[model samples]
Each structure stands twice: as structure tokens, then as C-alpha cells.
Target: MISSRSFVAISFAVVPFVFFACAKGSSLPGGGGGAGGEGGDEWSGPAQSSSSSGGMGGSGGMGASSSSASSGASSSSGGSGGGGSGPLPIVLLRIGDGVTTLSSAAAPVSLEWRLTDGSATPGAPGTTSMPQVISGSNYQLTLSGTASSEGHLSLSANGKYVFLAGYAADVGTLNVSTQIVSRVVGRVDASGNVNTSTLLTGAFNGSNVRGATSSDGTSIWVSGNSTTTGGIHYTTLGSSSPTQILSNPLNTRCVHASGGQLYATSGAGTFVNVFTVGAGLPTSTGQTATSLPGLPTLGASPYGFVVLDLSAAIAGPDTLYVADDRSPANGGGIQKWTFDGASWSLAATWNDGTAGVRGLAATPWGGGVRIVATTAENNENRVLTLFDDGSAFPEIVIATIAPLNTVFRGVAFAPQ
Candidate 1:
């Protein structure tokens, strides 16, 4: 059986560091190579081929017919598809005190929202207090402290609500070990206010809810650990209980829902657990875990992932972007995979010795896709990196916002 690892915490310190870049291309301080071989200081080289699995589409009641054909076709054409029109909104996870352990001294986490003008600069910080307001962005308001141990964030399909996953316990003197421990779910209106009362406690299995995503606004799927085992659970917004969808002892780390499918990664190895979500829930009772192609036999630990269903934009197939936190010595980097309505194939990989790649998000920019990633270095310094869709190497080091002595967790782009 795979063992679960505890979350690390960063020391307490407050430093505000923000840098904006407008250049179309800029290299890292040390110029790294591509994704495969060793380089001076940049990423290694492009991706290499790995093992493959038989098509799992038609097994376990998991088939592609349930996905919207029109949406898939539109995405395959590329560019902005269906509802991806307006300016892109950026949502970031800011964890205070950096600790994942339950404690009274733990500071509350916050979700920062800002709109981009297709440039690298983030919208200026709002002057108001708790509910910080971004003057000109679709997310007119920013919020924090609505949930404790909030490790992941996802917006509802309608863009009206934000779903959060993690554990929730009382703050300060009320904190205790016997407090509810589970993969909890919380919801907040997109109108910009952080209302703690809106958070739903004990909504699922009492485990550390590490990842969450919603296909439609009505239902949410969460992945997390419960003592000796980890599982994927589901619950509707405003509900008090979540039903266990799939249970495994693999130490699930993150999850993403797209194109009628749910993708989850495990910290135990390079396997990506895929599920067919039909009618807003898992169609079967188990997962179709597929090992990532092209990854070396050792040092491949998959973390957070994102699914880009360009089938609606380019009329092609859906793409999966996975962040592998393995050290540079073992080929640590980002891995790209393409699904042809069945199994997945290795597409590309990129990394620059900077391990701890956690969260991932992609948005339409300059008529193509722009990918943004978060890297937490030994839980000390957190860096946000950006890469162009088809670039040979990572394009820019957008900003380093973790100077506040906090570790960054999950990130998501506001629904377009």
C-alpha cells in the first residue's frame, strides 16, 4: 500500500514581491535546454515517448458519447471556443503561515482575483479591506478565510460560484484535533464577498480534501485522503453530505473535470486516474488509472493537472497538462498528453530544476493558449511561471508572490 505524505509548512514572514513582464519572450536567469537532457540552467528538452495502455474508453461504462460533440469540435479548432470570450480572470491561492497541519496559530488562506489585458501585469490590488475589490476585472471582488486548509479552487460551469476543497476546523482557541477531518466542500458567490457562513462543513468523507472540480454548477467532485485510504467523492452545492464515488489507497493529490471526464493524479507514482462523469457523476464504481507515457521508470511523481478540451476550439481531442515535481536529476517537469476519445499519448514536457510544480491553468491568449504554473521551492519561495502553448521552453517567470512566508497551493483561471 502507498503511504500518505504530510504537507509541509513555511516559516512566518511578510514580504510583498510583484514583477510584471510585457516581453513576448524572456529566458530564465540560467538558460536551460528543453525537456529531455541536462542543460546549463533552463529546462531539459522536449518530451520523450513512454509506455502506453490499451484504450479504456468503452470499459467500466466510460465512453465518449456522453460528452458534447459540438463543444469538442469547437475546441479542437483552437483559439477561444464557445464561452471563452472576455478578458481572462486569474485566481491564485495564498496560504498564510504555510502550514498544512491543524493548528491554532494557522493564518487564513485567501483567493486573489485580477484581470489581465493580455499582458503579464496583474490588476492593481484593491484598497478596500477583507473583501478586496478589483476595480475593472470580471471578478470585481477578492476573498479570503472562508475555509481552512483550502488547498484547491474551481469555479462552477456557470461562473456564478467558486468551489473549494480541503479540511475545515475552528480557528485560534477553538482549534482541536478531534475537529471534523475530511475532504470538505465550500461555495461562495462570484459577486466578491467572502462569507464564512456560506461554507458547507462535513459535506463529504472526513479526510483531507486536496483536490476538487465541478463539471456543471449543480454538482462537485472532490479527491482527498481519509486516514488509511484516499478516494474521490461527490456532492451537490448546498448539500450536507457527499457520497463516495471511488475509493483507493493511492494517495490522490489533485483532480480536474472537463469534457464529461474526470482526471486525477496520484503522489504515489505517474499514474493518472481517469473516470467518466455521466450526468454530473462518476458513471462507474472505479477508476481507469493510466501511467503517463514517456516518463522515466523512476522519479516520476504526478501532482496537480489540468484538462484543455480544445475539441470545442479546434475540433480535435482533449489535452491534459500534468506537473511532475520530480527533481531535475530524475527528469522533473511538466508533461502534456493528448486523448483520442480513448487512451492518452505523451505530447511534451518542460522543467528547469525548480521542483515542486503544484497547480496548473490555461487560458486563451493572443489567439492561442497560454499556460501558467505554480512552483513551490522546498516550501520557501513560490514562483509563478508562464509558457506559450507551443513554445520549446517555458516563456516567462511571471512573478514570485510567496515572499509572505506562505506556500502556494492550487490555482484556477476564472471562467471566461
Candidate 2:
């Protein structure tokens, strides 16, 4: 059973207030680059045929729908997608962990990657595997190794490089030689050929990793237990040595950067830690920090969290979405949160049935929102649940997606 003590200990371990004060004390430095051929065998020549020709409207499924549509419509649509000006790139996250096992012995963990068509329907409706063809173009990548734990894959606004975190004892980057096609144009079929390579290494920070991307995709935020100091720290894009943003010796599982702000979860605390970013990003070293209201009471610790700032939505600027995976045995369920332009607070709470939520990702679908989350282990299948802004949770299986030996860890989509 999940214990209250363990929950409380985990939540408060990485207190944001402690880190805000700590962030003021000292500073750390770091830099990053890839080791393969100078940009290696990246797509060099002219543009290949367009990968996505149909457009965003073609890719369907509640997950890829835009957030502007009505929630009722969003909840029922199986293959509807949010319209986009052009094709978008899809980012896949491989989540797993590593350890130096005994010589002649094998590693204890496995590598897994979760694939999401940048705008939903990177494949076809009712199809377990990604569609092989799209607008007379082919898509492929080189992939290797087993995903163990917490890692990241970040996509740019223009979709050039998909930054991957926590892999092969270091961070890696998947540089698409050409523009990524949207699901509407074509779907990604699993050939298990996605390329794998490292970008940064050396005493990397964090454990049970959590990461966030900047609006421009120029920067990212990662929070977790640090390998170098064993304390929780936040790292930015392109930096190997993190700026030790927080270190109360607590273990953090998730980190997010949005709307010029940073948020983190201790998975064992009552408060959602917050940080304010300056012009530099992951580089800013967080000049300021604050706490969000409506965190679980001490007994009901909030473990996993996600944040989305829909400033672009015609709705309002101060809107934020957060989820709390609670164990009644430990005290919570599927919870919701919101933030005005200035302060943050809770919105609603609901039970996601038997299995609780572990991770969350949001995509805009025609005036509404589509969310994907993982449930605690069930039978043979690890439950992947989908939620529309106004409805109950639904099970949407991503069966037969590639890189066989690898498991799906996290999901991310390119901005429309």
C-alpha cells in the first residue's frame, strides 16, 4: 500500500521555498554538444518530398485535437485534429534509467520510448501501428538501447532537433534531416530504425526525471534527484552541468517551463514548487520563486504534475492545467489546477477509475483540449488514458508502435 508518511516525505523533500532561498546562494556552470560526425549523416541536400500533404485536419483522435473546439465534441472525436498553418513535427520520449552493472552481468533495467504524432493521428484510426506512407514520402530514424527511466525529447517551434534527455548515461538529440510531416500528411510507422546518439554527459543531475520546454523551444527545464550531489536540481537546454536550482536533498520527479515560469513536483509534498525565469532560460538560474495554492494536505501528497499555459487561446491568459495522481490509500486521484495571471489555485478533482495517473501531456483540439496520461500497471497492457476538457477518462491504446524492445515512456507534440 502507498503510505501517507512516504507521500508526505516525498512531497516536502524538494520544497520550492527552500530552493528559492537556496537558488540565491551560489551558481554552477555547464556546456553541451554532440559527439557524432559534425552534424553527422544529417539530411544535407535539398528538401525531400513533403512528408505531410493532407494537413493537420487529416490526423484524428482526441489526443491530436486542438483545444478551441467544444469539450463535448473533443471527447467523442476519434480522429479529428486541430487545424494548423502547416505540417508539424512529432516528438517521441524514451523514458528509462541506467546503472553500471557488474562485469559479465546484465543491466537491471530496460529502455522504452513513447511515440506521439506531433498533432495526433501520426498514424490511422483504429490502427495499432503508425501508417507507413504519407503524401508520397518516407519517414525513418536510427534507434538503439533500452529505455530505463526519466528522459526528455524536446521539439523546436520549427521542428529541427528533438532534444532527448536521460539516455545511455547521458542526454541525446535526434536531429531530423528535414521538416517533420504532420499526421494529416502521413503517419509514423515503427521500423525501429530511429537513430540513437548522445549529446551531453558527465555527472548529470536528477533521478526519476521530469522536464519542461520553453515557448520558443530554445530552452528546457529538468528536475530530479541529482547524481552529482544526490540533491534535487534543475537543468536547462544545452547544459551538461545543471545550475543546482534546488537542493534540499529532496527527490523531484517532474519539471516544467512555461509562460516565463518554472514548476516542479516532489511527488511527496503539499506544495507545487515554482520558479521565475529571466531572459537566459535553463541559463537564467531562476532569479525568483513562489508556491502554488491548493496542494494536497500533508496526508494527501501530490506526486505527479503537468502545466500548460494557453495564453494564445482566446479564453484567458492566466489559465493553467495541473493533475494530481492520488492513491486513496495514500489520499488523492485525478485532480485539476488553475492559475490566474498572478497566483495559482486548485480547480477540480476526479477519480480516473482503478489505475491512477502517472504522467500527462496536453494538445489543443478545435476549441477544446486533449490529454494523455499513464495509469498504474494493469494486466499485459500499461494503461494509456485520454481525457477531453469536459468528459470522463477513456482508454486509448497505442499498440505496436516501434523500436520493439523499447517501451513508451513520455509523449510530446510540436506546437501548431
Candidate 3:
């Protein structure tokens, strides 16, 4: 469980760019709209709702332990249903996040998710997608729907889940900028089941949320880029909507929580920012984020990322992996950097193929790391797995999994 913090709510610089990289070539798997994927202050932000009757109202205190059911996106979006009796597989894919069209009808669909593996449980295609297994919490959330495209995902600090910031597709269009944009936070488990999820809706007045991350498994911080009221939205499991905790940095895209430290990609400057996590996401709205030092000026295209620690006794993370959706020529591809307590250095760059890689996840391998990634948006997009070792590559391609109309978005892989 996460403890609450006080926020003062500072004015975050509005992201002038509504990153809808639907440009000519590389873009988000061809669907809804998302471009590049920012925060501030003491505990001052949006006030919580006062509803008491929970089912799906706004105050969040109620949780319904219902069986996982089939949503409209079941046929097209990814899903979670396997009974994790034995060792669970790695990789979680966020299929349709509602905004994208799956059926020929171009109808809005619910959020969908799928759990498979890079090689162990091998799927024709993959996502959250990776081969290496990580250990985190003990619960999960199962999803089903047709999300044209959705945001990226992250595993909890302990590793058992893929934290997700999703819209409730059963109701309205989650175009955070122009609509009420109902969002939900999830803990996708090993059996591909989200045991307890957080619902952020009812009175949310934010915009363009794209990524989610958690320190423990109870609370989540969602990041996005909006021209107006968009920044860091927070909520606990089973809650309704969320409170905007900080608003300083602009165009906050993807977020990750590692080793008690909170890190995120900033669209405003195409760089990464770090926040000191005190139990949950920083509560003081006045809290300021520091730019991650030692990067080679990532000029946009920086999507989802992962930070891994080689040793717990070491105090901080030593290895970092960042996903840039631009072509190698334009600084696109997967970047592997190593950190020495004080600074980071270019360890290597992987951009052999797959146009440009977007969202990525990694696990410790032999002497290196095993990585899984989703290619930059393309009609023939793919889920790929390559190894630092303990894996393979021609880059094993996990493709034929989803229905033809579905586009795979965010992915998470955590093993316990």
C-alpha cells in the first residue's frame, strides 16, 4: 500500500506539441493519435472526488472481485486468461487501447491485453513483450478489448505486473484532450490477470495520458503530453479517476519506477527526467524533477524505457535501456547505456532492423541483457526478442498473435 503525500500543485509548462506523430512514415502503429509521450509542486493538485457508492463512481474505495469476463476487444485486442499454476510466462502486450479501430466498423473498443513469452512460451508475435523474467508483486489484471492503440506499460518495482494507464472502453472516447477520458490502472499478473485494478474516471480533468508506473503495486503515476491540463495523474488500486499531482515539466510521455526512484521521458526536450519516490509517486506538487544526466541529447522519438540494477548491494541501477522510435539515421533504435554511480556512458546502440523500435523491456542475461521490443508503427509491425545472451536473435519475431486489425501498443514483463 502507498502512503499519501501533500501536494501544492504548480503550473506545468503546457506541451505545445500534441505529438500525433502520424507523419509520413514511422508513427504509432497507425491508429488513434499519440506523439512523443512531463511534472511539479507540493501536494497541491486536483482534489479527490467525494462519491461513496463505489462500483465505478469517482471516489474509488470500492473494488468488485468479479471473474475476468470477455470484453468487446476480446476478439481483436490482447487478453489475460491463463491460470498461472506453473511458472508464468514473461511479456504482456496492451493490444487495443480503445482509440484505435479493430473491427471494420471503426468502433471504439475496450482495453485488451495478452501475456506470452519471447521464447519460453513463444507466441507467433509478442509484447510487454520480452523473454527475460522479472519478479515483483503477486497480483495481476486481465484485459480484453480492441484498442486501436494505447500507451506503454511498466512492471512494478518488485516485478510481478505490468502497470497500465488505460481508458474504460465500455463508455466514452478517451481522448484526454477533448473528453472526460476515463482511465484505469492495472497490475497484470503472471497468469495474465489483473487481480485488483485502479479506475481513474468520474471527475478527471486531465489530458493525453500515455504511460504508467508504480513503486509498489498499489499506486500508479500516469504521464502524458497535453496542450492544456495534462501532467502526472495519480491513483491507488480500485480508485476512480485521479488527482494531478505535479505540473512543471511539459510533455511527459512514458514513466518508470525503479529502485525507489521515479524516471520518465520528457517530450518537451526529448530527454529523461528523474523524480525521488517517497513510497509512491512524489506527492508534494512542488517536487521538481531532475533531468537524467549523461544522455546524448535524444532528439525526440524517446518512448518507453527500462532501468535495471546489476546488484542490490550496489545501491542504484547500473544498466539502462532506452527506446527511441526514430531511425538509426535520426537517432532511432534501442540504446543500451551503462551507469557508473555518478554518470552514464554509451554502452552500445542496437538498430539492426525493424525500422525503428519504440516501447522496450529487458531482463538480466548471461553477461549482457535480453531485450524485447515493438517496432515503430508500420502496417506490418512486429514484436521482437533479441538477447544480450541467454536468448537468440535473427531477433526472434513474435508476430502472428493478434487479429489482423489489431495494433499492439505498450508491453510489460515481470516474473515472480
Candidate 4:
């Protein structure tokens, strides 16, 4: 339900923070990291492994196949992963307001993470049983408002961090706006451990929470809702204050701060855009921004995306994977675009029936890439894994989450 003028909103369960629900069959649409060791223990689940031993192949265009293949495939993940016996990959996910981890692999899909706390509400809860300041901060947002909570991989001045961006809303009626009670950001280690007390004091119902840093991980550019900018902002380590950065064509959908560059999804006009930052990503605000060349001007609702560069040079990435939530006719699905010496081209589209995708993550495999994504805006949303070798293959279901009344949002690679 998008209009030329404004992005529509829908209240979810007791949490009235407007849920960013993209149309299942409709379309256009629209983040990163922080300190390390700030997260404490609070995880429980089976880890998925993505080894490149054997997989299936098919012929032709982007049409997908669900038929099973032999063991040894791939899963969704992060970092410049190539050869085998590498770092055990970690997949970061935003299930509700809280975040969790999945050990990624190439074979049988990982099992769905379910609530063992025994709350009557299994999926999205009306009143959260999670802590309140939350109480202990060691718990997951299991029985709570289910919405698009964006998670990103970032770095502190010292180490890598996973940024969990989300907010808690006061009890209210569905479809009716309510007061936003808490805007919070959780920091974690690569293993999904809570690192610090979450905090965010603005009106932003953060769609993407990320930060840009040089190899040093300081003087950064951050993303999310701000009281002043309403889009991307700038912040640093050891402090909670954020300065307004980008103002025009404001985007709160999702953002990525990497390699002295800022990439974000700016809605229907352009699928993805970028902003330039000073080297070292200096602590100051004030920077120049612009829409990227060759991206579609309309008909794409992109959520999570990965801009990857495997070349030896530090130039702009050559591979781009955008999570578009529109139907196949309207350009919905996981759109794979490749950059030549110049312009970008649509390489492929992966889908699950008519349903579209929202959150996403990827890493290099045996000369190919392993991708994991969440289905969106339908009664049958899911968290899935795919092994892409430029061929047609069956999509592996990690979990059919709609039955839990829950929806998955932003996803990222944990610090490797």
C-alpha cells in the first residue's frame, strides 16, 4: 500500500510502532556495526553449516526450482569468505525487537528458532516477557512486537560488533498509532551475545542501524531515524548522541556504512543510493550524497542488500544483491545485479512462489555465493537458504516462520 507521496504504516500487535509491511504482490521500497564483547550470553539454537562440497544445477534464466539436491550446498552469511576450513560463519537476524544467531552451512537448512520460555503467545506477543530497561538485557525479544527490526555488522574502535536496531511500543490497538516507549540498539559479539545496554533516544523507528568506519573503526557515519534528520545520522563510540547528516530525500528503510561510503535504499525512485564520507570517516557530519547510476528509477522495494568486492583493488564493489519485496511482475524477489566497468545489469531473480523477500545476507562460496533471506508480506513468510552457482536450484527452507506469527527483518554477517 505505497503512495507516490508517503509510505503507509500498519500497527502490529500491542506494539504500535508502525510496522513496515510491504505489499506481498505489490511493490517499490527501500544499514551496521559497533563495539565488540559488549554482548552477554542469551542464545539457544542449532548452528547451520555451509560447506562447498556438492550441490545441484539447472539451465536457463532466473526461474527457481524447489526440487531437492544432494548433501553439501550453502547457507546465507557474511565477510570475504572463499576457500574452505575458514571461520565458522555466523548469521545475524532480527526476529522481533531482539536479535539471534544462526550458524550457516551449505547442507540441510537450520531449524527454526522457537520460544522455550513457554509464553502463550508463541510468535508475536502483545506484552513482552523480555526485560524492560529491560531488566537483565540477557534475553531475546521472543514474545514481543513482530516487525522489521534491522540488524547490521559494525565495528567499535577496537573490535567488530553486530548492531541490533529496534524499538518497543506501548500497549495499543492494532492499526492504531501508539506512543513509542523505547528506541533501543543492542551490541553483540559475533556469537550473538549481548554486549551493552541498548539505547536510542529519538523518534526513529530504525529501519536500518549501521555505522561506517575505516580499518581503524572510529569516527563513523551511522544510519537510522533521528529527531532532526529523520534518516541517516552520524555518531561515534563511547557516546549515545547522533548528529543529523543526510537530510534531502530522507531514507529510513536501510543503510550500509563501509569502505568510506554509505549505501542506502531510497524507495521507489531509485532502488539503492550512496553518500560519500571523508577518509577515516571523520567524526564530523556534513557530507555530499547522490542517487546511484543505472539502478531502476521505479518498481523496486528493496530492503536488505549486500555490496561485495572480491577484487584486489579497493574500488567500488562489482556484485550487488538487493532484497526486493514486490511480486515477480512488479520486480519483487532477490534481484542479483552485476557491475561491469560502468553501469549495473540485472543478473538474476530468486523467489518462493508469489511471496517476496525483505531481510538478506551473503558470503562467498566455491567460486559462487551463498545467500540467506527472509520472505515478506504474506501469510506464509519464511527464513530460507540458497546456494547460487548461476544455475537454477531448489530453495532450502530454514524455517516457515509465519506459523509463529513472527516475521524476520534485517540480517547480516556476524564479525568474522
Best by TM-score: 3
List the candidates ranked by lDDT, beginning with the highest: 3, 1, 4, 2
Tell me the tens digit of each residue's lDDT in model 2 across 1-416.
Answer: 11111111111111110000000000000000111111111323210001111122121122211122111111111221223223323333322122221111111122222222223334322112221222123221111222122333333223232233332321132321111211010111232222222122322222223333333434444444433432233443434454454554234444544334445554334333332333324453324333454444354333334444444533332334433344423323334555655556655443322334444445444333444444332111132323334433222322222222233433344322
Off by over 4 Å in 1: 1-87, 97-106, 115-150, 172-183, 194-207, 227-229, 269-280, 283-299, 311-316, 339-343, 378-380
Tens digits of per-residue lDDT for model 3, 1-416: 10112111112111111111110000000000123222211111320000000011011111111012110100001111111122123443534432455331212222333223322343312222221111243222222222222357677776655666544433222332334445556565544454334655642244444667776667777776444445566777666657666565645667776656667766555344333333434754544656556775445456667776664556567667777666544545556666777887756445433245666766553344545567665322555444443111112223223344344556555434
Quote the lDDT for 295 in model 1.
35
Candidate 3 Cα RMSD after full superposition onto the native fold (Å): 17.5
Model 1's alpha-carbon lDDT is: 0.41
- TM accuracy, model 1: 0.62
Off by over 4 Å in 2: 1-149, 152-162, 170-218, 227-241, 248-250, 268-289, 297-305, 309-317, 328-333, 340-345, 378-407, 414-416
Residues 179-265 of candidate 1 have per-residue lDDT tens digits of 343334545554444432222344323334455666655677776554433456666765546666566533455665654556566
Please give the lDDT score at residue 177 for candidate 3. 34
Two-way lDDT contest, 1 vs 2, winner: 1
Of the candidates numbered 2 and 4, which has the greater TM-score value?
4
- Per model, state how many residue pairs clash: 36, 49, 54, 30
